[model samples]
Target chain A: MILTVTLNPTLDKFYWVDHLPLSLERAEEEILIRARKSTASAGGKGINVSIFLACMGVETVAMGFLAGHTGQIILRDLLEKGVTANFVWIEGENRTNVTIIEKGREYHPVKIHEEGPRIPSHAQEIFLRKYRRMLKRAEYVVLAGAIPPGVPDTVYRELTQEAKEAGVKVVLHAGRRPLWEAVKVGPYFVKPDVREELMVGDMPVRTEGEIIAAGKRAVEYGCQACLISHHVTGDVLITPEGIWEYEAKVPLTKFKNLVGADDALVGGVLYRLARGDKLTEAVRFGMAAAVASAEVEPKMCLAPAAIEHEMRAVEVQFKEGL
Target chain B: MKARDLMRRDLTSVEPDTLIYEVVYLMEQSGLSTLPVVDEEGKLVGIITEHDLIHAALPEYFDMLHSISFLPNLNQIQKRLKEMAFRPVSEYMKEVTSVHLDDEDLHIADLLIRKRLKQIPVVDGEGHLVGVIRRIDILSRLIR
Candidate 1:
């Protein structure tokens, strides 16, 4: 079973608008208002990963710190969706993240963010203890997202060390200090977006070579392999065998949103890895999942069929000279 | 099964000009612990409940009045009587969280049970108050 830890889970609220202007007094016309509407769902980085894993018929557990009425709603929703959630209840109400989708505009389509709950120290410790216990049954442990407030950047790093000691393959998807700190513990895999790579390593990754080189450097720092995702260029994976690049596939239909693409990418990569797929195949699957997520509506990830279709079309090739 | 289905469609609400005693009497007659207060356009403005009236009737300084010499008993009794007579229903009314009639699809009864809310006001898309939902209405749904 795969164990996914979401430090700060939330209730996601999606608002669908047609031709939403930045600063507007009123909407003049209907502007081809489709049956487009908003929806609220349980969301967070690790939660999305677990949801996708469950959808793919994978055995996975979602653990996190949830609180109040909103937290209850999230838990209920997750249970209804068939995702096993082992949440540590906190004091404050769980935060609600809002995603605004503009269906008409292609360039500026969706805006996604979270006003995540504040987790106290005691709650953080409870989460860590629960995660430690979960690691005993988990084959792969995925640590995702930034540590909520009151949590140190070294929290994931500590968890990575503990998972390593327990002989579990740990995959970390985080940014900046947490990413930098987690790599030293020698996780099985690390996924960092282009921005995270640049911010953490201070490495200029303009081209594929720069990204691959950065991934190699992370491996050299003790990580088994690294997958760096490029926003417009796609994703690149660096392993002991060589470096492989899987260009992102654009779906035929227009993209409704790109909120959960990163988490989807992690889900895909972990799914393939859990199946014992090679590094290249895992990277390809990860890119396919990312594209599939971008194609779906906000807060609703693409089903397995969409990812499978995208995966079938994805092509990966090795580059020369390491 | 949406919030609109379980919401009270025909509601007798009060305007700002309605007397506090009259509002209390209405609650007593209707067997409601709380009532939704609306404006002339029938838009929900506030809410009045028994808890508010009880709080309003509490003496300002019962502690100090109890320490007075000869007239302590008389003063305390007089204060209690004044509080009961002058207490208004508006002072205790709570502000109901408004819900859009067309937007929400979940059953209002289920939401009330889940959120532990006593009452919820239903409003139109333009924010005009249309109806009110009471706990009894939700209970009746369960019974049926």
Candidate 2:
């Protein structure tokens, strides 16, 4: 089974408003806009990857800390989505992230984030122990997203390092600090978005050339493959074997929800890798997954057959020096 | 040399939810006296040994019968063994005394001598299981 870690998983609550029933003029008006509906999903970087992985027919086990009622919902949602959970239970409740939106003019969508439970030293120890056991069972591990408070930034580095030492392949798509630390562990794959690259690598990315250079620098730092992705400019892959780029299809239509597209790419690539697909094939699969995800809102994950159809329009170019 | 230099990196462990019959099967297959019980994270929770299996296999009244010098009933013991097979290893796993990764060889030797330990689970400073130091590993290396 594939292993994914989401240290600070959250219960995301999305509230939709039909209209803003408020008076703009200086007049006494009853201000009330009832929420048309509210929906919740298991939200976290690792959880997102695991959900897509499971949807794509890969056996996946998502590991992390879950606490209280919100945590139980995360667990239940994962089960309902056919993703196996191996969460470590904690005392504090899992965090709840609320997003309120009104129509397409959601210019100021209100978002409330809760601080997750603090994982004590003993619990951290327990999690590390659990991770070790999981390594033996998992062929590929995905370390992603924000870590809860009390977890050292270097923890991701340690885990990736240990996993590499144990000869298991690892894929990391985390935030700045953990990504920065874990990149030095020489994982098989590292996917850092353009903004995140600047945030952690402390490198300026003014142009595509700068982004590609940063990815190359990350490769030099230790990762075998570094994928620097940007929505508009496209993705640059830096690998020792070769450097390549894949631009989004021209005449790109407006995106519905780009939130999970990156995760889909990560999961898509890993799915192929787990199934022993070559790197080039895996990259194409990932691009297809991203395109499929970007075109729609949070819906069904692109199956391999659907990805194959999506890949028809994708264009991959091999990039030499400059 | 410290335990890290001698400890074997090929650690074999089972989770707390592992079944008793499976543990017995693994132990019987590998000829190991015990298997360390680890949680989902590689932290050491407990250890299940052959003795624990034997203890659980016998009827509860065996302790009471031992002082009275009774032969006791053999069929009842067999029935108890069947019942115990369905239980999890966590039910009977013995609490383990582990050594840290940087522990001196002398300390490990002392523990082995006093506790009569055949293998010592080596944990790092953060309490993650790093490796296991077996008596035979030390003996073989010293002889080499």
Candidate 3:
């Protein structure tokens, strides 16, 4: 079973307008267009992973710290979607990440990320104890997203060590300090988006070669395999043997939202791994899921049929002498 | 109309491993003849009703092997009643008759009528328990 750790969870609210009211002097001066509440669901990297895994019939459990009414709603929704949840309750309300999407211009969506509840040091200890207990039974322990306040960056490093000691495979997905710290734990898989410049081992990763170098560097840090996802140029899989790059075969379709495709890619690959797929097949499967998810709405995940279609278009080549 | 539009969100269900004594307490308190059983993920896996309880509580019917006499063993029956109260409901709950919230109106209506069920648990797209719809909820709408 897959266990996802969402250190900080949020209640996401989406407000769609024809155009955001840039300025309003009075009620009459307000930009008048029909506004609607699109959707509000559980929001967190680990929570999304759990939801996607549950959607694909995987037995996934999501653990984290949540609080107040927002936490209650997130818990209820996650349970209703068939994902088991064991969340520690805190005193403050969870955060909300509001996205103001323009109807015709979702490409440039405005995101408002609130600073989540400030967790106490005692709560950190409680969560750590819970995570250790969960790691005993978890086969794949995913350390997801950013660490919240009062939780040190070393949290992932320590948990990674605990998971490694328990013989549970670890998949690390984070950026900057947290990612760098956990790199010393030798995770099974590390996904760094190559589209963004991720400084892995003091190297600024930009091009395909740099991305491969970054993956290789992660492998030096004790990662078994590393997956580098490119935004438009496609994705790459780096291992000791060779570097396999995948060019997406996505058909032309008006993408509803491509914002969460990276997260979907992680969920899809983990889903395949949980089912005992080989490393290569898992990467290919993940690429298919990523492309398929980008082709449709974020709510609709990549299904097998779409995966098949996307697979036909994806060309994976193992480049030698890299 | 969709099943979710009319389904009651306040659910009263139990886990598969809940003790029979607690099951009896919950059922009696809720006044429900049939109760849905869910897993840790809250997926509707089975249902335990008064009938299942009766089947366990009273040894009216027996699958007991190689009985010389047709007479009911009062001692054995009493022993079963006593032991069943502490046993887990996983062995008793029946896994049948669950509807998805997005199920077609005709299909859910037919399933309910044909099965002679008062209500059934409503599952979401992922087959997790969401709510329940009773016959009275439909009846009230039809009459109105």
Superposed by TM-score, candidate 1 places the C-alpha of residue B119 at a distance from the truth, in angstroms, of 30
lDDT of 1 by residue, A236-269 (tens): 7777767777786575355667777888888888
Question: Candidate 1 lDDT, tens digit per residue, B60-115?
Answer: 56456653454535666456546555454455567677777664535665667786
Q: In candidate 3, what are the lDDT values of residues A53-115, reduced to their tens digit?
A: 888988777888888779878877887777767556676789988877676665566788887
Model 2: docking quality category = incorrect
Report the lDDT tens digits of candidate 2 across residue range A6-93: 9999998877786754355647655766898777999887888899888887878788888877877887798767676666666678
Separate clash counts for every candidate: 3, 7, 0
Q: Between the candidate structures 1 and 3, which one is better when assessed by TM-score?
A: 3
Reference-based lDDT, residue B27, model 3: 60
TM-score of chain A of 1: 0.90
| lDDT, residue B59, candidate 3 | 48
Instruction: Compose the digit string of candidate 3's lDDT tens values, residues B1-144.
Output: 778666665345676777887677656544567788876555678988887886676545555643426755567756776788888889888876888877766777787899888788888787776677788778777789
Show the colliding residue pairs in model 1: B47-B93, B48-B93, B52-B92
The RMSD of every model to the true structure, in order and in angstroms, is 15.3, 15.0, 11.4
